[model samples]
Target: MSQLDTAWPAGRDVPDVEKLIRQTREQEQQPVCAYIYDLVALRERAHRCVNSLPDECKLFYAVKANPDPQLIASLLPIVKGFEAASIGEIRTIRGVSGDVPIIFGGPGKKDAEIEEALERDVMLIHAESLHEVQRIGWIAERRQQRVSILLRINLRRTLPEASITMSGRPTQFGIDEIQVPEAIRLVQSLPFVQLEGFHMHSLSNNLDARLHAQMVATYLQCVQGWMQEYALSIRYLNAGGGFGISYTEPERRFEWNDFMEELHQVWEDYHIPGIQLIFEPGRYIVAHCGYYATEVIDLKTNHDQHYAIVRGGTHHFRLPVSWQHNQPFEVIAVDDWPYPFPRTEWRQTTITIAGELCTPKDVLAHEVDVEQLRIGDILLFHIAGAYGWTISHHDFLSHPHPHFYYINGT
Candidate 1:
């Protein structure tokens, strides 16, 4: 089978998993929820993604996905730059990107953040609001620098949404469609502000390649009309990335090769000079590179429903609760169950996996079928490379943070 078609967690660095499992057996860490990443696999996957795009498309790693130092160091050399949403993310990428470009974008940004953007000399600051543009201009004027700006427009259009939507309609993420004219005026009025392009990121975890390509084509056309109507020159078109990875339906995942193939047609349909395409993918780039593991603490059946309580709760890995999907998992059985009491084992039975949190929303997977699960069994959640740790509320109830391990190997 083709590399792209291969089932994930199959070709990944399994030796690392084995090593971690052995560590758990040795009691190196108790009830640990560890994220294991294969840097080599990530390098290969990212290289393919970067190479598949046309010359106009430049890939930027969104640091909010996973700002782990090792993750940034691995992707820093592969991607064009990092796209950050807050001051902390900007600082995180700055330490590793070196001369590579960085873009700062987020709504309701503080004046202090604007100052930091100027001091850091970001490639472009996406103006999500009219006031944000004025703030950027204010900062640039004081610094005596012409700051490049990308006007983020929340269009009136909609696409097939995944789990979340970052743009389109009246979202706090970007300026509304009707407000663009006033926004343009605000940018043009500033002496130190340079309006170079537009940023339209409408959806998150979008899986349809043809629809995604169509959205980009439509976005470019829409931007072109606005530029001509406003008499502005568009130098860059940031097709902010919402490319998706399948959490439940792995077979229905986005086809990178097919999507890029369609993108080739989309690019040719509206190829323009001096208009560099920017793709800031947060989930798709790193979602498949990391794994989250938790050990089973207890097994019980309450009111005819079987359940397995895990060591960590939504405080450590919250994607299942956020997405509201029974996350897929694999059971790594342990031969040794050190408990003195009689152990509960299930076969040909459905079980709900829940976390140790007191809240009812601490469920990880519901009604999952397993083969012979004991108290010491490990549950490894796949497709947790992005938004797994960082998105979680680790401080809830002041629980101990899970151990994080970055593994690169043969």
Candidate 2:
């Protein structure tokens, strides 16, 4: 792929990976590293994805993945809105750009959160069930205001990597497909609630672009049928965010042009006159843009096998435990010459990676190869921009979170 295609904001030459690593070490900035190039690449990818969508479609950055204020601020101008799952995120977005449209989603929202969203005039409140709709309506009515709402709908597919799913069996999230009609009726009955359209978050690790298009088509059909049967005009259709990122080697990159083409075809086939398309892409937009930099505290041999132990563990990059995601990382000394090795050989050895914590589960990678891992060496874990630091446990042995930096080239 071209550099522009791989970098965020598009069209910039990134610093050499090895060069950046050496700089970090020469500065003695242990546990203080950033994925400068990765963030750039992620933004580029996201921009391409948004540009590929039809004119009517809108892209929303799901802030739950990594709510770095700088990242959100940088994306505000490029994206249509922000998908906030918590009150803090809502407030953060508002702090960055008050006028940026906000979509309040997630289950079990606190009353204060709803009140805050209403108080701030959020663009849309995604109601996961009839109860949430009623609650939002009650809050809006007491506040003497009307709020736009979308009923979160359950889908047919469930993702294995996600903590929550709207498909397959019963889930605590969106109302079931069968109950959507009644839920719609209830939402319509509420004076302060405006039923905008349907919202569905199928799965997180959805790599198939065609499957995404198929799901959109199916959802459009369902919404069309509902609109016709109920004689109601739906204003917005939200296909909730489940875009996947490459966390493992042989990483699967999201095919933006192909996916958008398929999505456009589906949109043309099921065009709704006055409806708007909204997409919440969290991981896809930020995953590859971030990296985790940790130092090799020690090295050892277990059963005649080499292992490099770093200061961080599953507490910092938990995708390995949560999704069994094996993110690719590179190891290099601060000033040592690059050890020459064939690509095929580098890919063949088993150099197990571990973190500083004592638990065996602290392992980061297994059967990986590094030129020469030694004490004080730095390892740069790539494509960690999405859920890397935010999802990790900082309290584990009281190891403070790594420092972060944001780099954008114009």
**What TM-score, over all chains together, does every model reach?**
0.94, 0.89
lDDT of residue 113 for candidate 1: 90
Question: What are the per-residue Cα lDDT tens digits for candidate 1 across 1-410?
Answer: 12344343422666567677668657765765677776777877888788778887899988888888788899888899999999898888778765679888888789899888778878999998887888788888988999999999888886666767876656788888888899988888999999999999888888887889888988878887887799888789999988878888868877776777778888898876679999999888888888888889889999999999998978988898998888877888777766687877888889999998989789999998987888888888887888888889999888778877766764
lDDT by residue (tens digit), candidate 2, 1-410: 11224323321333455556566666754543444434455566667777778879999999998898888877877899899999999989999997999999998998889998888879999898788888998999999999999888875554344444566567787888888779988988889889889897777757666677778888888899899998888799998778655566344655565577788789989989899989998987877677677877666778898777787878877877667656677765544433474211222446888887768888778877665655666777776777767787868888766655555654
lDDT score, candidate 1, position 387: 86
